[model samples]
Target: MSIEEKVTSIIVDQLGVEKDKVKPEASFVDDLGADSMDVVELVMAFEDNFSVQIPDQEENNIRTVQDAIDFIKENQKA
Candidate 1:
């Protein structure tokens, strides 16, 4: 799968949400009903699955599925 597809799948699995609900613009907290802990776990899942280190400071900007995908696309080791 592509990075965007992988990121969306991860969010769906991590948050237990429907695939249709994991749109790129959807917010993890506001749109997907994820709390702080869920967000943290999601970040960890992305890091582990993509083999990328997402710094704490960057977490704030990764509220949307697209943001996480972009960040991983930019930083993940190929």
Candidate 2:
């Protein structure tokens, strides 16, 4: 699967939300009903799945589904 598909899958599984709601523009907190702890877990899940380290500073900026997908695409290990 592509990076977008992988990221969307992770988001749906991590957040316990429907796949249809995992849109690129969806916000983890506002749109997806994720709390702060959920965001942290989601980041950890992303790191584990994609084998990339997301810095704390960068993690804070990852508010939307597109942000996580972009970060993973840009930083995933070769």
Q: 37, model 2: CA deviation in Å? A: 0.4
Q: Can you write out model 1's per-residue Cα lDDT over 1-78, one digit (the tens) per residue?
A: 998888888888899999999998999999999999999999999989999999989999999998998999899997
Go through the candidates in order and give each one's C-alpha lDDT.
0.93, 0.96
* Highest lDDT model number: 2
Query: Candidate 1, overall lDDT?
Result: 0.93
Which 10-residue span in candidate 1 carries the lowest summed lDDT? 3-12
Residue 57 displacement (Å), model 1: 0.4
Candidate 2: tens digits of C-alpha lDDT, residues 1-78: 999999999998999999999999999999999999999999999999999999999999999999999998889989
Cα deviation in Å at residue 59, candidate 1? 0.7
TM-score per model over all chains: 0.96, 0.97
Report clashes for each candidate as comma-separated counts.
0, 0
